[model samples]
Every structure is written in structure tokens, then in C-alpha cells.
Target: MLDQSLLSQSRAGLSEIEAEYIASSLLRVCPPVSPQHTNLEVTKLLNEHPELISIAVVEDNKPMGLITRNVFMEGMAKPYHHDLFDRKSCIAFMDKEPLVVDQNMSIQTLSFKVLGSGRKTLNDGFIITDENGDYLGLGNGEDLVRVVSFLQAEKNRLVTESINYASVIQKSFLRSSRESMAAVLQDYFMHWEPRDKVGGDYYFCKKFDDGFFLALIDCTGHGVPGAFMTLIMASFLDHILLEDNRHDPAGALAIMNKKVKTALGQINDSAAEGFDADRFSTKQNGQSDDGMDTAFCWVNTQNSTLTYAGAKTALFYIGDASSDVQLLDPDRKGVGYVDTPMDYQWTNQQLALSKGMCIYLTTDGLIDQIGGLKKIAFGKKRFSGLLQEHYLKPMPEQESIIMQTYYDYQGKQKRRDDVCLMGFRF
Candidate 1:
């Protein structure tokens, strides 16, 4: 959180301006004045210190006054630099008092003051000296302005960095899909085109001695909060599969539904309006934690058996020999809409497995994309057709065809929502 915008990208951590500020660059108290020299000699002195910042006059270790070249020339009787130099000694031209400055004074207060005050005593700066008052340094107005700007910019950068670190932690806390998978058919891929990078779309897998568990879920919102729901679902599903070895898909859903209702406080009448809360207050008003709409199935490849359960989603199966498929429509009762008629029962469907049948699941994003095939979505009709058209291709090629079709259809239309599709073939 420390401000570090002033951090030098170069090897030189200190800048020339900063160094000058540190040097207390100014004429004061006992500035190296030229009262001891004549005006002619002043020219030589100027030539010697061509890089001179300011000139002054000193007497007995104290500042008498100061005069710059401009003032000296304006008061000169002759036009030539040498004439003015020869006409008077530096002491004869000492400007006046209040020309000196102290080291501790801010450079910010000095430079603009000088410019605006036209070299008057009221605008004069303080002289800075060492502990011994030995004329240690001088201050300037411009440097302070620059330093303040640098500090402000540095502060902003630090704030941004702090926010980024916090975001990384929050995102990390939201779980991602498990990649270490085993058993059954490993021929699955994700075509996850999220409306945002982290969206409500989710999929998970679990392997059991008798069958393999698979699911596709989509939450309510997109981005960070959707990802949070995804994480919650992942944790719960993992707990059910690994810890309890609960192979019944409907049983898992019933338990998960209850848990989510409790977690979101949706069981009470007061929280019934949680789903319709304003955008900003959704998190506070207990927005739908039932973000996941899932189609789950446990496959017993050895026994050629399948048990599937779904909620407010759809799944399809394509016969292996050709392009014929079955679409499994969910029981319209979503994960969370209302606990009203709390007796709503979730059903699990059983199917006999065939060697050539391919399994497919998708969120509405794909079918509902709204712009494909002449500005029209490849809706249910076309989706089923694609199954009939590409059913013979390997799962990977089949996926590519869908992507190709998406691009071909979405040439100019804006993408509407998150799209996800998964396929498994026996």
C-alpha cells in the first residue's frame, strides 16, 4: 500500500532535480557573494560558473544582498556586458535584503513567488544552512510542484496495486474446474465462451467405482459473483461424491438444493423476494445462490447403465451409428425460483446404454445465442440437425464444427451471452 509511483525505473533511484532539492540550492545567509570583486571581475566569475543558479553579495559571513545578470544590465549606463562589468564592483550593485533563502523552506513556495513578485523582498525565499549555519543549500519553487505531482501519482499507483492483489485473492478463492481426471471416457472438452472472463457457467466430474459422475452448471450472474457460486457448487459436489460416495444424482440434487436454500436464506417468506432485488443490493438481499442449473448423469460403463437428473437445463444424446439424438428437458422447476409448493419433487431418469451413443450437455447460451444462420440462432431445430449432421465425427471434430458454425454465423452480430457445450462418446 505504500506509494511508490516515484519508483525510478532506471538504475538511478535519485533524479537530478531531487538531488538539487537535497543540496538546498539557493543563495542565502552566507551565499558565495561577489561584493569582494569589481563589476569587471564579475564577468569572469559568471564565465567560470556558467551553470550558476543564483548570485549574491556577502559581508562578514552574512548575506548583504543579491543581483542577477538581468538586473545588473538593466541598471547599467552602457550597453555592453563588459562596460557594466568594468563600471562597478559587485558590492556597488548588491540588490537588497530578503534575497536569500533557507534550506528547510519548500522549493514549491519559492519559484512561483519569485516569478510573480518580480524579484521583490515580499517574494524572497529563506536561506538554508547546515547545523553550523555554513550556507548548506537553497530551495526553488518549481521543484516542489513537481515533487507533489510525483507523490500524488505514486499514491494512485499504490492504490491500484493494492486492489489488484485483493482481486487475485478473491478470484483464487473461487474454485476452477478440476483438471486431474480419471477412468471412463476421457474424450471431453470445454467450449466455454463466457459473457465475461469469469462467468456463471460451470462443469465438474467425479469418478466412482461403479460409475462416473458428470455435470454442467450455470449460475445467475457473470464475472466474480458467478464464479463464487461456481466454487460453492464445486465444493458441495466434491463433498457428495468423494466423502459420501452418494451415487444417486437426484439425491445429490435434493441435498444440494436444501443446502443452497439454507445458505441463501431462501426458505423464509422474508427472503422470498431475494431474486428480484436491485442490482447493487442483490448480494445483500440474498440473491439467488442457486446460480447453477445442472444436468447430471452417472455412467456405469461396465454395466451399460445411465442415471441422469437435471434442473432447469437440457441434455441430449446422439445415437452412435448416425445423426439421431434425444434431448432431455429439465423439469422447468429451477434450482431456485420459489420454495413455494415446497413439495416439488426432482426426478431421475434411467436409460439403457448403447455402444455407439454419444452423450451431450449444454447451457442455454449456445441454443439461445440469437445470431447464427442468417442472423438467427441455431436453435433447437438446427441443434438437433447438427447432431444428425455431425454425429459420425469424433467428439473433437464435432466440437470444431460447432465453433466453425458459430464464427460463420456470428460474422457481424454481437455475442449475446455465455456459451458452453460438452460431449462424451462411448
Candidate 2:
């Protein structure tokens, strides 16, 4: 048996690419030497094919071990080695502990196993087997490297194309014009940042005769799936608003919740509450656990009032120079929970506005970001302090300060989720 100590060391800290299967490079193998094959018979077979570096020793279709050309030649070169051993079975010198890999094993993983083996290199080659442990073929370290490199390049290209397309689609949803938003709330800023090229977070702004509708929403997941949900949400919200000309924040939310449930076929899913429909039925069953947490606000400068409603989202408010920052909490439930009552209600909270007062609406992404020395959440307390400290600045300046502060706090940490923040002053 070969010392496999090097293989054990190489297995540590292997990268993700090593997790891929070896099916692409699988080679056909045949004419394995039996354990009973005499060394003279094996030598003659090897000599006939000088190019064959190794041969498998198998019994009943199961691989027993491997024999390399170098070992055979070295043994034969020994004084009287062939005459003394040629008639003996080749199994006496076969590598019983040779590197063996399942056909489905990833090439990276196989490399780790081979390199970690106490051998200086995998020059002896290795054996591949089917799931049932039937001998498949012999593979070289060099060939494995070539195939894996090609596969990884192909995988990277496909992913890049998909992400670029998704980025385009996500940008299209941010269609609200600055003029339209300014017509409703004279001074406001909306910041939308996705954790990836595309994200699960989005902001919506629309103006009607009574006032303007503004919202920040965080969907269930991030990346492509989350981006898809954001598209669905934007479409549905627009359709709901136009259907009955509903402008009230709470009523709009109720419509959105019902529509999301119906779209996902979760209207009848009380028994499997919260079950992810997408996991079970990707084609037509729609999404389960696919809902948004949102903060919706209506501002009417005519009456100097702000009305807001939320589904698992909140609002931060600071009125005038002397008023303390305030948090307007949302209901505990988000939109589209499977068990949510069709008749469920949302609360519409109203507040009187003073000159130079600021209102903030955000998805949980901001407060939930992981960072700090302890790697804890940024939290609502710190968020509130940020707003309170900078609310006095112009809306545009405030946006810059907030973003810079958030990035400072985040430091080198990976972004945790999509973030959306909207601020306005009356």
C-alpha cells in the first residue's frame, strides 16, 4: 500500500470548483489484468503497448489495484528479479492503496486526494469507478487539470451573461422620473442598492391628484430570484393601483397581499403555511415564501400631513429642530404569508407635518446589515442616530452622508442584503 499522507493534507481548504463531477473526462477502460495473471504475462502485455503508463488489476468487474510501467521496469531491472518473480502473480507488486476515484467525484476533489497521498506526484495515475464500484478507466493528473479548467471557464461565461442580462432587467423597473417625484414631494432622495448585479430590494414612486405614493420594499431572496420577484411586485403594484384607482397606503397593501397569494397559488395553502411553492412546483404553482416586506407612505402637501402603512417595515421621522426622532412600527406580518387571512387588515397611520421635518422609509436591509467589531447587525438604534444626526442637511446632502456612513460602518464586510432608503421633507 502507498503512503496516502500527502492526500490528506491536500484535502484541506479545497476551493468550491473542486466540487464538480468528473463525467466530462471519463475515459473508456478495458482488458484489465486479473490478480492471477503471471508477472511474465503482465510484462508481455505492458511491453506490447509501451505508451500505456498503467494498467488496472480487477476481479469480477471490481478494481483491485493499479500497476505502473515504472514499477514493473524497475523490478525487472533488479539482478535476477524477472527470473525469480516473472512467473509469480503481478498482484504481489500491485499498488493496493492506489488513488481510486468515483466517476462522479469532482476533479478538484480528486486532485486533492491524489496530491495529499504521500506520493511525490500522481505519476502512477489512478482508477475511476462507477457508483457500484465497477472499474471504469485510468485517468492522469494532467488530463484532469485540462478538463476542469475548460469546464470552469465555460461555467463562468454563462454566469456572467446571465448576471449582465439581469442587471438590465432590474434597472428597467426604476422608471419613475425625477420631475414626477419632485412634483409631489419637493425635496426627497431615494437610494436603491442591490447586493449583487441585481437585487431583491426596490423603490416605487408615483404621483396622483391627492398626493404621492412612495415605498421601499425588500423581497424574499437576492440575486436573480429576488430580481425576478421585484419585477413581479412592480407589475402587480401598478396593476392594483390602476384597477380601482386606489391611492390609500393600507388599501394598496391589502390588494398587493391578496394578489401575491393568488399569483403563487397560496390562497388555498393554509395547511402548508409558509411552504415554498417554488421548490415544489417551479412551472405553475408560483412562489411560496415569496413575498415582500414594504413601507408605503402617502404625502399631501395641501394638508401638510403624512399617512403611512407597512407590512413588516417601518418609518423614521424627525419633526422640526427640537422634536426627537420617532419610529413608526409596522404590523408583525409581511405580505403573502400562506396562512394570512384574506380579510387581514393593515393600519394607516397619519402624522401632522411641521416645516423642515424629515420622513424616512426603508427596507430591513439597512438595519439588518452585518458588521461592526463584533460582526453584529447595524441595528435600528444606530440607524436612528444616523438620521437624527444628518436630517438637518439638504435631502441630497443627507443621502450622501448616509451612504458614506453606512459604507464606513460596513468596512470590508460583505454586503448582507439589498438596501433601499427613501427620505423626504415637508
Writing each residue's lDDT as its tens digit, candidate 2 over 335-370 gives 876666667889999988888888888777788888
lDDT of 2 at 136: 85
Identify the leading candidate in terms of lDDT: 2
Q: How high is the CA lDDT of each candidate model? A: 0.57, 0.71
Which ten residues in a row are the worst by lDDT in model 1?
Answer: 2-11
lDDT of 1 by residue, 255-333 (tens): 6675455444445433222222222122445443344678878777678878888987777887655566787777776
Worst 10 residues of 2 by lDDT: 271-280
C-alpha RMSD (angstroms) for model 2: 23.8
